[model samples]
Target: MDNIGKRIKHIRKINNMIQTEFAGLIGIGQGTLSEIEQGKLKPSIDTLYELSKHFQIDLNWLVMGAFECMNLKEYEYELLRKTRELDLDCQNEVAEFIEFK
Candidate 1:
């Protein structure tokens, strides 16, 4: 999706959640969620962060479509966490290995 609203809506739909249910999960009102999905209102940073944390969404993709919507498995999430602990050079090496493989 090109816009944050669309992306949010896509996430909800893909997860089989209605506005009320999804809004409740993210601590938002159904009306506010509707407004956001309609692009009539922008989501606050707190809302974005909640969405990212709750859904394991990639903020980059949610904000700018910079990456795929990454719903990582548990092991994948652990791998990412471990990779992030590495120094920049080691991170680059890991990335290169992944890319090459």
Candidate 2:
């Protein structure tokens, strides 16, 4: 998607809501909704929060077209993957120690 408008449109279609219904749900006029989807208008942060909550969408995905993956550097993902292999009790202990530190 080129911008937030396209992402919003994609989400609306995927949720099976037309402009009128989606606008009603989001508490905006259909004309305004159309303008937003057409890129003539940008949605405010409050509108974005409403959309995210109503649709169970990740806000990062809505605003940016992709989930903000874990901000961890390369080694972190590998470390976490290995950490998951530990027994549950051990994992909890490790987690507790990490928090304590």
Candidate 3:
């Protein structure tokens, strides 16, 4: 489990996504993702890029286990996603509330 594949699998698990869903989001087949997770194959650069971009994964940590996999937990990511959908004024209010708390 000390490889890129394992790390990617970890990301998927923490996000509560199954292989089919995770692979679909990354534009890869389930079989390919399975092989990668099993450490029988390495992920391509494009896949790596997608993983980092879509899941907010840290590339350095994904490739080298150099740091934390993600700076935010799943709940925090969900909160941020929801915040981004709010109107600007509401967003500001939410930020202010969080800061005050």
Candidate 4:
């Protein structure tokens, strides 16, 4: 685990993609990919952006090796979790009981 390279390798392996396949998907040759993974070459910002685009991940996560991939607020998470717990059987009754009357 050598920081960026390690994270890249970790993510790649987690996704079940070989270095060659990941490299090809990201538009880099296997040799260049090897160099990057070995820390022989730091990826340029543009390259990082391209990699982010390729993986649909934030460039900051790729560059800084940030552990969090999502930024869900605690309240948002709780609200969503609570919303899912509402019984569907009572949904229509609940909806019809508006307080306006």
Candidate 5:
């Protein structure tokens, strides 16, 4: 599976969300979510944020693979803004660096 796919699956499982249920919460078709989880397609930035909101995860972590899993606040309106500021692809590399250090 691609990085995006793994991230999606990881977050979903971490949150205890089933694919079908999570897809509903994210307002996407389960088939599409499944494809994304399977690494068949890339999600747009908007979609990424939506999933982050649904999962209450750090947007930057979700997109770039930076933090393994950010514990985002339920009502943090600015979380998305902070998440967008992070450079794309920073999450995965950051996670690795954190692990190595």
Candidate 6:
């Protein structure tokens, strides 16, 4: 797999999300996501942001494979990951808390 594909695959696997499910979450087709993972296709910026936001991955890491992009705290990453599993209201509460902080 290519760099981007490798990172995408790693994030998805670590999150325990299947390609079809992940694709659906990202508003992409399963086939498109599969092709992306195979390095046969490049995802759009919107798609990249969707994946990054949903998976709580660094956008630079997702786009440029930059592991050193940001020094994110483990708890911060955990919070981001868990937030995706929350319902909209719960997520809004978390967002509001962050904003208030």
What tens-digit string does per-residue lDDT give for candidate 2 at 17-83? 9899998898788998889999999998888988877766667657765532545543553356457
What is the TM-score ranking, best to worst? Answer: 3, 1, 6, 2, 5, 4
- What's model 1's overall lDDT? 0.83
Model 4: pairs clashing at backbone N, Cα or C within 3 Å: none
- Every candidate's lDDT: 0.83, 0.76, 0.84, 0.65, 0.69, 0.79
Listed per candidate, the RMSD to the true structure in angstroms reads 7.3, 9.3, 4.4, 10.0, 11.1, 5.7
lDDT of 1 by residue, 37-91 (tens): 9999999999999998887777886887655445555356447745866889999
Best by TM-score: 3
Candidate 4's residue-wise lDDT over 19-80, tens digit each?
Answer: 89988888778888788887888766766776767655555657764434456553543344
> TM-scores for all candidates?
0.66, 0.63, 0.67, 0.58, 0.59, 0.65
lDDT of 1 at 99: 100
Better of 3 and 6 by TM-score: 3
- Kindly report which residue stretches of model 6 are placed more than 4 angstroms away from their true locations once superposed: 68-101
Top candidate (lDDT) = 3
Cα-based lDDT at residue 91, candidate 3: 100
- lDDT-best of 2 and 6: 6
* lDDT over C-alpha atoms for residue 62 of model 3: 79
lDDT of 6 at 101: 100
lDDT (Cα, 0-100) at 24 in candidate 3 = 98
What tens-digit string does per-residue lDDT give for candidate 6 at 19-88? 9998999999999999988888988999998987776777876787554345655455556667977999
